[model samples]
Target chain A: MSNEQDSVSDILEDNTYKYGFTTDVESETFAKGLNEDVIRAISKKKEEPQFMLDFRLKAFAKWKTMKEPEWPNVHYPKIDFQNISYYSAPKQKKKLQSLDEVDPEVMRTFEKLGIPLDEQKKLANVAVDAVFDSVSVATTHKKKLMEVGIIFCPISEALKEYPELVEEYLGTVVPVGDNYYAALNSAVFTDGSFVYIPPDTISPMEISTYFRINTEETGQFERTLIICAENSYVSYLEGCTAPQFDTNQLHAAVVELVTMENAEIKYSTVQNWYAGDKETGKGGIYNFVTKRGKCQGDNSKISWTQVETGSAITWKYPSCILQGDNTTGEFYSVALTNGHMQADTGTKMIHLGKNTRSSIISKGISADYSSNSYRGQVKVGKNASNARNYSQCDSMLVGDKCSAHTFPYIETANSSVQVEHEAATSKISEEQLFYFESRGISRENAIEAVISGFCKEVFKQLPMEFAVEAQKLLTLKLEDSVG
Target chain B: MLEIKDLHAGFDGNEIVKGISLTINKGEIHAVMGPNGSGKSTLAKILSGHPSYEATSGEILFEGKNLLEMEAEKRSLAGIFMGFQYPVEVPGVNNAEFLRMAHNARRVSAGEEEIDPLDFDDLLSEKMKTLGMEKKYKERNLNDGFSGGEKKKNEILQMAILEPKLSILDETDSGLDIDALRVVAEGVNKLRTENNALILITHYQRLLDYIKPDFVHVLSNGKIVKSGDKALALELESQGYDWVTTAN
Candidate 1:
């Protein structure tokens, strides 16, 4: 290795995860184990109907028989599923009458996390559902949405008031038997945002959710579902932050989206979970999430954009089921793992209808001793004649100790399928750093600029409010990788 | 403007520069002509505080401050700029954004306000016009796929925008044709004032034909062995370095 690379590697080794502070609020924490009784208690605690209870029971049974997946290019000690607590909700959580009724403490925490609760204080026209611990504390712009025949509320509330919509769409894109983590999420998901845009009416505001995992020794299982009727359009974004802790916390979330004919949905997330410390890799969130969207009708569209910079270990593949003719799907993601963080994330596109199209652009960055990988698959069904899929996955490494890997799979049963795959792996050259530094740019800023440039394409796809946020987050996460 | 005393440096543990020392003055242009592997590039890299070139024994004073004690960027902020021979290709970084950021960095260090994007565009356009660069170059990635001549022109353009007091051009004329060399030299010449100095490191005297140098120094093996007027560069261009290296 070059002398410069050696020093950069040393510099990267000294960085610690910054957003690791635990809130002292009391939570109705569950017992540190998983079972039928535990699952039933969670369902009952949420006041879910019998069908939801039965669904949880069946999912729990299925989860019990399934084994943990180990195919991802990541390494961690085996997760003790039974030892993990299934739920933890803030004790003060209750049906909030208004945003003013939200606990002042929760409001303060969100403010410190850079999430604004006051509607007028928001930088963009986004309606946020702030989820603290295991419950949604406040959801903004609900009355205005209701005026437009739009349904935007907590999924738990939707399950109670709009049970049919919840039942018909929940687990439809990502079934309970989808994977081990998805099955577990289906059984014990506490609360998440729900959105239903009525036909032919565009959402007046960008819907969003801000999830904060505050307590220790608890797992967060949130199930989010979005349904858009014909000719409707909605753009949604989600952000997450967690405090530092010594013990690893489990976060298994399931998000599903359904769009009808001519409907469009744009979903984005900027996740900065508390990665473990720098030395021993202790006290980080283990984020295993299952997110998928389905184009259920002709000419429908769905786009997923995410910037993941945190989590000790992340295994997620936000996918698209292109089931409608002439429908289009997109996945644009930038996943950066610094310190000892490990992330194996990408997306899957399943083309099932004639003339369907999908595009994937994923960028991964690894710094310090972290390992980041991109595992993606593109599939074309036999009847999906003239289907087109294009994917490009790139990885960037900052230090000599880090590693980047890319694994892409393409399976086409039809002969007319048009699929393109492009992949590359690179390291920040010392010459590049020197070139910037020689012009009065600090080493950290130079590194940040290079990375921001690498992720320009994906960042432009994010909501205007979050494109700048994602850029700043990437700089903070990789600042230590340069001297 | 700058003083270097007994500078000895190299990569890893081997000393590529063995006790080479020289002093530079404001308003003066010093051309250090040398062959390949004569430690010319090493000197430039060391002056820029590149992590690779370790200075074992040296004292470089820039405006009465110990230049070696500062980091690379601090040295830059203190008015030292290196016009790289082979400019690094940053693929996705836009040229206009990169120049604006560099401009803003100096401004911020001087406690001046940052230029807004709209105003920065005007300033960048003005500079590009002065350098005879195309408007589309602003949108292109920073030297990513630029030709050799274009890359050299970019270095000079950066030097013009940064307006450093001490500029070191390391073989900035190596790959340029006559017209590009003249354009690049004109940009450097336009930026030079009585308060600034220039160090042009080159192998051939072709660039010196355009950008006149006040003093010419011959560096071989590691240290400067000959110091003369611009006539020395003209002599070396015809007779080559043996006339100097063998003379010593």
Candidate 2:
């Protein structure tokens, strides 16, 4: 059995450096910079409404007053926000009415990321909205989704036809003044998928948004808003990947979710960013984002599951605020950091109403001098009587050079609430590896298998497409250390 | 056939198996009996290409191939299987799914087509019956909450399904009752063939009573000190490993 693990680990070690290829997409990227003019120009290019202009201006004002958060346990060279291009789009000569009309360059980029733009493309049994840089390039299986009265489209279009619905849900969960990145996202966000499941409806298909970074020096700021009306159900998955590059890039995005009475929302993310330089740490991505969901009505539920395996620096926490009686919130995460990358992430479950419940399971893996941390807070308010919360955070270190930390904060103002937290840190055992290797799995495949098993709890939450991609992403991040 | 030529191995630079040499031909069952901490498990691990065992000096050859040079999985693909003393539990990975994956990995490496789900189901059912396992065991997580005996039986089931040329059982009877021990031994015996080889590592002669080893060796202080026919196992069973440790 130990031999089996060793064999599996060997297989993973050889194939771990994938997702390092850049696509030859014909993109029209702006100059490397950001300012009031850049923000205004982006809005002008999108042909924004007057109200949107005002919203952008207000968000910019708030962003100007907000300081970059220093609390996250990540270290990257100071991001010169002024040097990042705020907008970039592919060079498509025509407005694409279908996948055929979309540029081949755009299609190739999606294909390279394993998201083909073909009409028959089936990814993990979910409909995909492949967004490259700042634009939604192509959508898959729209006709089938439309049949269920599920509105899944780019946020820009959602603001047009479903204006009332968008207006009501937008900024309701994550307001413009939520945080530094959220404010910046509000000011210059480009395009993201907007999903609306009508009352009493269970979406027949899983909705996904695949983000790819194409041009250099461009910051991809996408804002996603999903609303599940009363008695509605929806599961949404988001996946992001970028080519290996030598210059650090910026990706700041915001995602907000709202679940009304008796509604349930499950959101999952698989983040595989290029983890810049392993030697000098010259490039990669600085991913700072805000994501939150609110249970606004009684009996509503919100769950967040994330598998993070990439990026030079990641500082995002998808949280849930239980504001209604009998509401439930959950967060499950598996974060892997290799090379010189660092990730400070977890979740916040705020119990504000009576009888609210929350559960959190966090797993962090650190290899090759990387540092990973799981910092979370679960707060039960005074009115949150009879609330229950449970948290389990575990960390696995692949090598002696890496570090994993767990910092959980629990506060209960109501004595009737029950909160329990547990944490454990361990390394891949030599005995475990030997057991697998003897069974004939290569060392790399064994490590991959073990790591994959370590993350199974969170990976199962991802959509089929993202799950495969996540597994591959983890393989790449931990490949070199398997031996 | 397998050959160990003066193999010196250890962990963290501390020698566990100083200098050991052994050879087992096809269709033979070899048993190595040792006391606790006598390097019995270490030898089994080294044979399976475990990375921790730094073969300081020596070589292992499996079927004319440099066994030490091959990766763990390659060894398995080359018809080597190790039944663990204590199996690792992989949560969320179904037992049947893991078995199929392991089976297909070897098949692919051998340039053979993978078994489809239907074929796998049939193969699994047959093996399960030999190990006294129910069909439902296939869907459960790999040894997630399996009892000690069940885990050992599951290892035998894996060996039966894989049908490797060389099978290494490391203390497979450690925590099993008499009934479970007999069941596992029977499964091993059922899978035995002229083209296959078996290496059983145990602390007592009780398992030898069922599997009936062709050769029995006494291992002490990281070296095999005595070798004889099956009667040697009975002598050790009557005397004890301590006697052999001091006799050497």
lDDT of all predictions: 0.88, 0.84
| lDDT over C-alpha atoms for residue A56 of model 2 | 82
Model 2 lDDT, residue B223, Cα: 90
Candidate 1: docking tier: medium
List model 1 lDDT by residue over A1-483, tens digit each.
Answer: 144465566655655455566667767888889888988898888899898999898898999899999898888888888787778876763566666766677777887877778766653577889898788888878888999999999999998999998988888898888899999999888999999999998999899999999877778889899999999999999989888888898999999999999999999999989988866787789999999999999999999999999999999999899999999999999999887899999999999999999999999988888999899999999999999998999998887988898889999999999999998877777678888988998777787789889998899998776898788788867766643
Which candidate number maximizes TM-score?
1
Q: DockQ, per-model, please?
A: 0.56, 0.35
Pick the DockQ winner: 1
Q: List the residue pairs that clash in candidate 1.
A: A20-A243, A20-A244, A21-A243, A21-A244, A245-A283
Give me the TM-scores for chain A across all models, comma-separated.
0.95, 0.94
Candidate 1: residue A181 lDDT (0-100): 93
Deviating ranges (above 4 Å) for candidate 1 = A1-16, A93-95, A98-103, A118-124, B11-13, B116-119, B176-183, B186-195, B237-243
